[model samples]
Target: MNAWSNDGLWLAGIAAVAGLTASAASLGWLFSRNRYRAAVPDSSYPPEVLESLYHHSPIAFALIDRQGRFLDINRDPADMIGYGKHEVSGKPFLSLIAEDMQEAVRGLFLRALQGEQISQEIKVKHKQGHAIDLFIQTSPLIRRGRTIGILAFIQDFSERRRSLERIRYMAYYDDMTGLPNRQYFKKRLEEKLASARMRGSMLAVCYIDVDQFKLVNASFGRDFGDMLLLQIAERLSRSLSEPGDLARMEGDEFAACLDNLSSAEEAQERLQEILSVLKEPFELRGVPVHITVSIGVACSGGEDDAATLLKRADTALHRMKENGKNGYLQHSEDMDHVAMEKLTIQHEMRRALENKEFVLYYQPQYDLASGQIVGMEALIRWMHPERGMIFPGDFIPAAEESGLIAPLGEWVIEEACRQNKAWQDEGLLRIPVSVNLSFRQFTEKNLTSKISGILEKTGLHPRYLELEITESMTMDVERASQDLRELTEMGLHISIDDFGTGYSSFHYLKTLPIGRLKIDRSFVRDIKQDPSDAAIVAAIISMAHKLQMQVVAEGVETKDQVHFLRSHRCDEMQGYFGSPPLSSNSAHALLMEKVNRPALPAYH
Candidate 1:
């Protein structure tokens, strides 16, 4: 028989395989009504060629009899269910479908028999009884103006379905710790919030921060840091009983949404238990390392939304850290006031930088032996137009948190260098101006280049500029050593500020090419009264002198404290005892007096 002539099966099969909207039933009616002389196109292939394509096509094709039994199926569709063409030729087509979906599949087949095209996704049973997803499209095969069979085009959909599942998993989960990410957590929080609101129940949201995790990351290596994070995640997972309630919000930070809470007190009790469990030391690389967390919790109120509740918890966390870490704090109204003040300050700092409202106040550093002003530290002050001068303590923490410190620090260095050069141009005695470097500025990449550019732009000699870094910057000793070495090579001076207040490792201290150490005010304030502070001051001064580094005592107010520092051979002192941080013009006047007078100022 000629496949492409008379029967019209070739057109039906081709249209079904090509997924065209033109069904064989409608086409057969059109041809019969028109009595088309060109029923088979002149360009139609030979009968054998059409038959070969029907059996060998990669696409799964099937012909079903009016009884819904498989009349003929291509190799691909047979292989889809682990069967061969000969084996399934006489079997009922619905037997290949999963039992639960067989009725739905039969309805669709009946609709196709009624001259309606059917397309749907259904699960079919393989030879091994496992389900395989398939996208099947069926069309009624019309012969001589009546339906004889159904043509189906089947496509394996299991791979695409599995791929979509993997994509969803990645989107909702943290790849490193395998916990819910911030987006997923937020979604869950919203769901829980809706449920709690409906039931007149309360829930709690918590924001947790790992104390000093950055220091640990710097001290150990990133690989070890990752291991520590994984351990922390596991511990948190074990602590929380509810699945999907806990999430890794960010680096060293986690959040939890606690539902089914009877009262805020219950949430607190549960958090306390978690804290107790965390008290046990974590074993990483066979070493027991102690870690602590600071958590902030906010219980849901009658009108709380997810974002508002989360912010409240974060505010509480900040309060916990401010009050000192290794503890937790409950969100209160007062904390919001504090958080608002901080936000206002941060906003003002941005404007202050843009408007040049931030000014440098110079505090004179006196040489203890020579009674002469040698250097001065640059202190930042916000000269608010209406509020007078706003101090560092009021705004610095906000700037640090808001990521405004890097640009502010750069401005400070540039302004200090420019002022120092201006003083030199006016014939004032040459004195190095020291600028404190914030942690963000110190750790930023290409810091040496930044400083070098500032010096070149201001036309100031590098020797007359000093950069002060805190002891925390030295926690990564090797990197610190290399960074400091680069600065020294450019002839810039380096000083360790607030030396005893941070990770004070004497062994790490000896490796850097630091020129000065400033003893913290806490020690110097009680140096004469407290024996331990006195001993610490004495040791710091002695050790600094031994290492050929100059010591500067901070906050030296009383004459007795200055006398003690002088007796200890402290190289310099800067505090109210000498003079409080001065304006640029005042500092220049004092320098001029030192150059003209035989005797220095009163305190000296």
Candidate 2:
């Protein structure tokens, strides 16, 4: 009975404790819910959230009056403007804006107060007198369903705007010369064209290229070349004081747009002045280095646009190069036709390789002393399917410009080798076959490999293959020397063609692995008539003999030319008089007959 009573008392005590715990838990829950609700203000909701319901509470906010005066400002607004609450309570918002933008600020505030939203780029002055570019958005502040003040959101955009301006300048200006570049030039040219069309004024475009600049760069190094170019830019800038635009089109090339030109002659005179100024020597690294320029001038016609004008200028520049460097040429209808023809030729040449439209003509080279054939030069001719035969003069330069010379050169080498091997197989004694290498081919990285591969494929001895490179082609001495060494090691013969035409540095010639020097046809053609030509030819032949190198006279068209070359002990001769370039079969027959014929009597 005692144990039962104790158990029942314990249970009753436990029940009483549980009932108190439940009441306490319920009160605590109610207190926490109320505390949470109180901690968060009703106005804590975002503007987007509050717009869905009517809620009001105190927070930092601003309200500008219709006249741009502060009707009501919160503590945050005063902090934002670096002012006390009372200081901005009734102050005009325009007072905080930059002086130059006060009227704009007033107008924006008025628009917002009139029930319109305003967004604008503006400047605001800080208490320190510094102006900040700002993006501001103002909305109407409504009370009792009537607009009374404005609420604005501001952001700083000074850095972003400045960055954009910098990018704009970079896009339109040449970083090196600080002049308007091609992009800016084109933009200005378009504007000028539009104005000129209305005013019936004329404009001219001139393209200028530094003559023999590659030679300077090759000889003096690129740093000196850059210095030279900078000097050129300065001189060019000084040369033009007229209202015109100048731009560096590319490396060692520049263009100018001359607006309000009265006539082509005036444009020509201006270009001449520019060219004359450019001709002056530039002091680079304390050394005065002279440079010449070629100018191409084009004037705007009724049908011309900016692109057409530039094209015309380019065409004129090409004509200047063709006519000989260091002069100016004006664009004409004839130039346009030539440009179109070149375009057509370039397009057709792309197909020439695929169509196998090229043929090899051999010009026999004679031993001047023996009057016997020693070798032949392989000349390329384009057998245009529809246009008949086209001389190299018509299309070789075009091929070079289009970067097709390398492949075309490979074709020439392979064909020449094959023909030479064929002649050898026909019991004709093997003779060296020389092929003129274009400047593009000589500079190609794969030149040696291409020649070696062709010789190996055709089973022709490398000694029987001679490469004739001009003096200008060897400007890159180190590279050319390396290439020449590699070629000579493979048993191929190398000769410097047109010896006196370019800046022939005898010092460099001695270093090259060369076997012969071919006097230029220009010197040899008039050797019999002009003492100057004779003297040059004689000097060249004499120099070649002293250097233990052979000399070949080209363009020996008359008996007198032949006699003079013989007197000079010239080693070989090739020209129209000996025989023009002949077909492959005829060349083979001639070679056989010459080798078999009795030697001519020595000149008495």
Candidate 3:
């Protein structure tokens, strides 16, 4: 029994040893797995390994002390500053910084030491005395819950900053002329105006518009036009080189701000200089193109703000253009009053067509050869309740400005056609009725449909409807050709009104489907005395005849004018000599008399 008990104890001891060995191996495996998990996580990177990965980072890294001294630096900093790490350690950080930035560097270091982070993009001088922009971020390096040093990560940002500056410049300046654009100029002008008001300094704003730019664009292509504008910008820049600011407002317009000028005389002289430069012909794409500029000057006394000053300048510029371009005009109280009057007139004119205040008067077109009425031009007369009769010369420009001419023109067409039909129904002489067409009306969409609708409503034939358009109307050849062709196809007669007043291009006469050319009153009124007028009138008649078109002379007021027109074989005469524009009833009565009685003497 004692030997068996001893054997059991020995077996128990061996089993205990084997259990201890297995427990030891299991603990070892668990410890290894825990270490691996802690080191790798899901990314399989340890803290030390991740930190060492950027040890060779290209960015300059430095440790700065609280006293603005370099404590330690990475290899990149050593290479960047042409110094070994050992050489730079314990040196004053400001020693390596540029002299201009030393105080800033010290302030940054102090801020970082006070537990505040510092970040700045600044230019620094390299070891070779070359400047480089650096993006610097300095953070406090805390150790054992106490701030010890600052870690600065610096990246070379010279190229990046330069690129950003380029983008900023492009945003603020015109790409073609390099002048400040409207947005930037507005901001600058606002700032200047505020300053000038505070400093009690005089400020002048000039608005400039290039005259005949459309002609330039038409004669030359857009590319050549752009070149011309560039040359003009150069000249303007040179001319306005005084202590002022110049900018390209838009298109062919420019704006300038003159601050602290001694007197208005100085401003005027500056304007004259700019004008002189602008008057010189610009050689664009090897073509010597001439352009004149009209300028409007507005001072700060009349206008307190930028927008008002700009508006005043624009008003003055418009007046200059109206008075014939290539001159300078200063804004005055009278101009403001005139502008307000125009605005009131425009507003009233808008309601004119809708209020049924518009009326048409008939001016008889006399055929000098037969001494009989051939046609009558429908002249617009506005019968304002308070103002009585307003002639076409007064409200026509207003209508054109307000863009009411299109709808007004449609009304005129309907009224003229109806009047002509009424005359025929009254047993009066039936003759073609001519109506003036504005440029906008002629180019309006669905013009053909509008005219057709008018004819159908009035029961008047299209052959008796003559549209009188100006020479400028045919300048847009492609669009005008299409419109004229469509009007001709619809059996309407087209006439070029005010023939010699505009830049008449004979090239268009051949292509235009025109029926007649009306010599402008400017030439006819002077034809008896002015040699130029006589020559122009004769040439126009000859040209009209060669193009197989009839010639009509407008504004013939005297016997001599009528004789001259008849001697020149003019096809028609419509003026005071024939009959002033009369009321519809009076015109109808006259037509009836013409049909019943014999024709009048040719001279009468």
* Residue pair clashes in candidate 3: none
Greater lDDT among 2 and 3 belongs to 3
When 1 and 2 are scored with lDDT, the better candidate is 1
Q: Candidate 1, overall lDDT? A: 0.84
Query: TM-score for each prediction?
Result: 0.82, 0.78, 0.74
lDDT of 1 by residue, 1-604 (tens): 2122432544444454555435565655533313333555535545555556665556766778889887766564555778777778778989889999999999999999998888799999998889999998877777687887787888899999999988998999998999999889989899999999899899999898999998778878778888898888888888787869899888899998778889878988889877887888887668788999999999998878888899999999989999999999999999999888888888888988989999999998888777778888999999998899999998888889999999999999999999999999999978899999999998888999999999999999999999999988998888999999999999999999998999998877789999999999999999888999999999999999999999999998888997888888888898997888989888878888777442333344
TM-score, model 2 to reference: 0.78
Q: Per-residue lDDT for 1-604 in model 3, tens only?
A: 2111222222222222233212322222222334435544736544344234335445555656566676555444544555677777777767777788878877777877776657787666667777677888765654435565666767778778889999998878888888898777778889988888778888888998989998888888888888888888888888765523888888999998878876899888878888888766788667777789999999887338888899899999999999998899999979999888788878888787679999999999888777789999998888988889988888888788888888888899999999999888877776899999888888787888889989999999899999999888887899999988998999999998888878789889999899899988999999989999999999889888988999999998888887888788988888898788889988887887788453436653
Q: Largest lDDT belongs to which candidate?
A: 1
Query: Poorest 10 consecutive residues of model 1 by lDDT?
Result: 1-10
When 1 and 3 are scored with TM-score, the better candidate is 1
Clash pairs (backbone) in predicted model 1: none
lDDT of each: 0.84, 0.77, 0.78
Greater TM-score among 2 and 3 belongs to 2
Candidate 2 lDDT by residue in tens digits, 236-272: 8777764337888889988888778788778877877
Model 2 gets an lDDT of 0.77
Model 2 CA deviation exceeding 4 Å by range: 1-61, 71-87, 210-244, 248-252, 268-293, 321-328, 368-372, 474-482, 499-513, 522-543, 557-570, 589-595, 598-604
Report how far off residue 530 is in candidate 2 (Å).
Answer: 4.8
The lowest-lDDT stretch of 10 consecutive residues in candidate 2 is 1-10
